[model samples]
Every structure is written in C-alpha cells, then in structure tokens.
Target: MPFFVYGTLRPGEHNHDRFVRGRDVRAQPAFLHGGALYDGPGHPFATDGDGTVRGALLTAAPAEYPGLLVALDRLETYLGPGDPRNLYERVVRPVEVPGSGTVRAWVYLAAPAVTRTLRANGPRIPGGDWLSHRPPRTDRLLPPPGPRTP
Candidate 1:
C-alpha cells in the first residue's frame, strides 16, 4: 500500500530516513487535493481545505506496510482510531501521482479541532509544500553564489 506523506515524513525531512527509508519500496512525488497545511510545533499538519498538498506517495511492501503503519502511528502520536489524544488520523485519500495518475493512499490528517486551532494562528505553508516553506539551513557548506566583488 502507498502512503502519502506531506510533512517531516517526506524525504530529507526530519523523520523520513528514520521512519520511511528502507521500509518503502518506491516513492513518487504526488499531490493531495483539497487540503491546507500548517506549521505545527516541530512538524506540519494537513487538513481538508480548498488547496493542494505537495507530497510523496510511498509504496511499502505488503509485509512491511503493517509494521510501518504501526511505527508511523506511534511516531505521529496516534493512539488509535477516534482517540482523543490522537494528533493525527490515518485515512485513505486520493493522491495525484505524476505519471501514474490518481491512487488511493493512506494519509495522516490533523483532527478537526487541532486543525482549527493551528489555522487560527499558526503559519500556513504557502502552496502546501513543507519542503518549500522551510528556512534554508545555516549549517550547509555550499559556497556563496559568485565571488564577492568588493
């Protein structure tokens, strides 16, 4: 099964390699329609809205899916279906895969109350792309563009 991840769970983000790498058989850039993304405490959360969420559709081996889902559920702080303490709810949603068209994939979404609170004050990630909204790393060693003219 494929899971759509839009936040830190996406590649190169904080939790990707730790949680998703190796577990996933393949990953393709994809988009979730009708959603808005918000910057949470240390990650991002998505809610149903009138926008598109940029993400990746990751295919996990059938045998790995169950365990992966369990680990992800724990990582996302989801106690279980309808648990009040749940920060996210796993649901099946349609993701638009570039070359493969639409596919149903599991996605984690913030609870409605959580979504409301986050949206009321938290910064909305422009274009629903977490990777795009992140600030550039100050620790990277890339040289400054062109030599200084001074």
Candidate 2:
C-alpha cells in the first residue's frame, strides 16, 4: 500500500531526502479527510479528526518496499499496534489522491497518548499542511555576511 505522508516525509522535506527519495515509484499530491495536523518538536503530528490534512501519496518501488517500510517504522517510532513507546501508529486511512479518488493507504498518526496531549495543549497547524505551516528556520547557515567589510 502507498503511504500518506503529511510531514517530514513529504517531498523536499529533510526526511524525504533521507528516507523517501529514490525509493518511491511515485509521489503525488493527496489529502486525508477527517484529520488534523499539529506542530510537533521538529516535525508534525497528525491526529484523526474532522479537518483535512494535505499530504503526498507515495507508492514505494517494489524492490524498496520492504526496507522502506522498516525504515519508516523506525523513523516514526512505531512498534506495532498499541505499543506504549510509539510516537505514531501505522494504520490504514483513506487518502484522496488527485484524479484517483479515495484509496486506503498507510498513515502514521499520533499515538493515543500523543493525540490526547496534542488535543489538550499542542499548537494545531492552522492549515493542516506542514509544508506551509512549519515555523521559519532559525538555524539556516548563511555565508558569514560576505566577509564583513570594514
């Protein structure tokens, strides 16, 4: 099954380069209905809800699917269903793929505890799109101000 990724794993994001690039057979714009996105420490967390979340649907290359799945599971801290240490839970969710209608895809949603906390106090991403809602980078490396002419 394709994976619906809304956060770091989306195209051009850091994790996309590290974990998804070259491994996906195809990546296309998709949306998850009945969901919400919230700002996490350095990424974003999705929770099941009434909002719509914009994302990408990634179909893994057949040769890469097995490894990719394991890598993603590790990356998301998912350790099977109902694991106490999981940050996300891998589950099948209906993702609306452009021109293809809705299809069931793997989505990593915030674990139960994380969802509860996020609902209680986390900052919800207003637009439910992490790419557009992420905070500005404060750590960008500049070229030392062009040698600082005296």
Candidate 3:
C-alpha cells in the first residue's frame, strides 16, 4: 500500500528529502477523512477526529517499498501493534487522491497515550494542512516601540 504522509514527510518538508526523495513512484495531494492534525514538537500528528487531514499519497517504487516501510516505521517510533513505546501507530486508512478515487494506504496516527495528551493540551492545526500550518510564535514579547534612536 502507498504511504499517506501528512506532516514532515510531505514534499519540501525536512524529512521528505531525507526519507522519501527518489524513493517514490509518484507523490500527489491526498486527503484523509475523519481525522485531525495536531502540532507536535517539530512535526505534526494525525488523530482520529471529525475533520479532514490534508497530505500526500506516496506510491513507493516497487524496489524501494520494503526499505521505505521499515524506515518510516522507525521514524514514527512504531515498534509494533499495541507497543507502549510507540508514539505513532501505523494503520491502513482510505485516502482520497485527486483525479483518482480513494485508495487504502498506510497512515501513521498518534498512539493512544499521545492522543490523550493531545486532547488535553495539544493545539489542533487549523485546516488540517501541515504544510501551510505555522506554529504560534514563542519569542518573548517586546515593549511597544520606544523613541527611535538616531
């Protein structure tokens, strides 16, 4: 199955060049329904919800599929099904590809523990589009403009 990438794994993101570049047969815009995106430490996490998450469906080259699967599992910290240490759980979900119909693809979603935490405190990414989502600023606030120095 193709992988549905919704966060850093999407094209032009930091992880894309390192993990997905040259390994995919095609990467196209896709959407996953009944899901929501939440801001993670540096990336974004998808969880089961009522909203739609925007991402890409990446069909890996036949020769690269096996390795790509292993790599993605490791990157997402998915040790196995129901593993306590897993941050994300890999599951097959239906993704809608533009021009094409819906296809079942591998999707990484926040694990139960992570989802609980996210529900309690994590900020949801508006519009569920990680590529266009900008995290809120964390920089210290500055005082109102004082008299300009010469």
Candidate 4:
C-alpha cells in the first residue's frame, strides 16, 4: 500500500525513523490538492479542499502493510473509522507523484470540525511545505529582572 505522509513522517523528521524508515520499500516526493496543512503542536494537521500539500508517497511491501498500518495508527492515535477520539483519519486520496502521474494513496487528515477549529486558531503552513517553516522567535524583552531583591 502507498501512504502519503507529511509533517514528521517525512524523511529526516522525528517520527520518520520510528514509523516508516525500514518498513517502507519506497518513498518519493508527491503532492495532493484540495486540502490545507496547519501547524498543530508538534505536528501538522490536514484539512479539506482548496489547497495543496507536499509530502512523500511511502510504499510498503504487501506483507508489511498490515503491521505498518497498525504502527502508524498507534503513532497517529487513530481509532477506527468515525471514532470520536481519532486524531487523524486514514483516507485514500489521489496524490500526484512526479514522473508517475496520479496514484491513490492513504493519507491522514483531521475531522471536519477539527479542521474548522484549526483553521480559525492555527497557523496555516504556506506553500503546503512543512520543512521550510521556521518557528517564531522566543527571545525575552529584557534580562530576567536580575533575580528578585530581598
């Protein structure tokens, strides 16, 4: 099975080694349209139509598909289809792989309600690329108040 992975699941990201490294037979750059990506805490969440998301198309051996799916589900905190607690839903969508044309692949996306909330509150990742994003500066305005006086 082929899975479309963005955010931490991309090669070199934190979760890639643990969840996809050796388990997958192949991975290549791919693009999916009709959705938007957002900054959600340590990772990114995908929302419905009208934008593009750049990611990798990871393909696993048929024999490894089941196990890989289970592992990914655990990492994503996905319960079953329509489960209220699911952090991301694994859905099949068309992804355009360079040189390979369009292929159907499994992708994780947020629920409709959650997508709305994220849009309202989260930072949208421009260009749909996560690796290029830099976190906002966090420097303090002044020194630490020089320890408290007695």
> In order, what is each prediction's RMSD in angstroms?
5.3, 3.1, 7.0, 7.1
lDDT of each residue in 8-124, candidate 2, tens digit only: 899888898889887655899999999999999999999999899999999988889999999999999999999999999999999999899999999999999999999999999
lDDT of candidate 3 over 1-150, digit per residue (tens): 999999888887768878988775589999999999999999999999999999999998889999999999999999999899999999999999989999999999999999999989999998999878855434325666679979
Candidate number that wins on lDDT, 1 or 4: 1
Model 2 vs. true fold: TM:
0.90
lDDT of 1 at 115: 79
Runs of candidate 3 with Cα error greater than 4 angstroms are 135-150
Candidate 1: where is the Cα deviation over 4 Å? Answer: 137-150
Ranking by lDDT: 2, 3, 1, 4
* Candidate 3's TM-score: 0.88
Candidate 3 local Cα displacement, residue 113, angstroms: 0.2
Candidate 1, residue 50: how far the Cα is off, in Å: 0.6
Q: Rate residue 8 of model 3 by lDDT.
A: 84
Runs in model 4 deviating more than 4 A are: 134-150
- TM-score order, best first, reads 2, 3, 1, 4
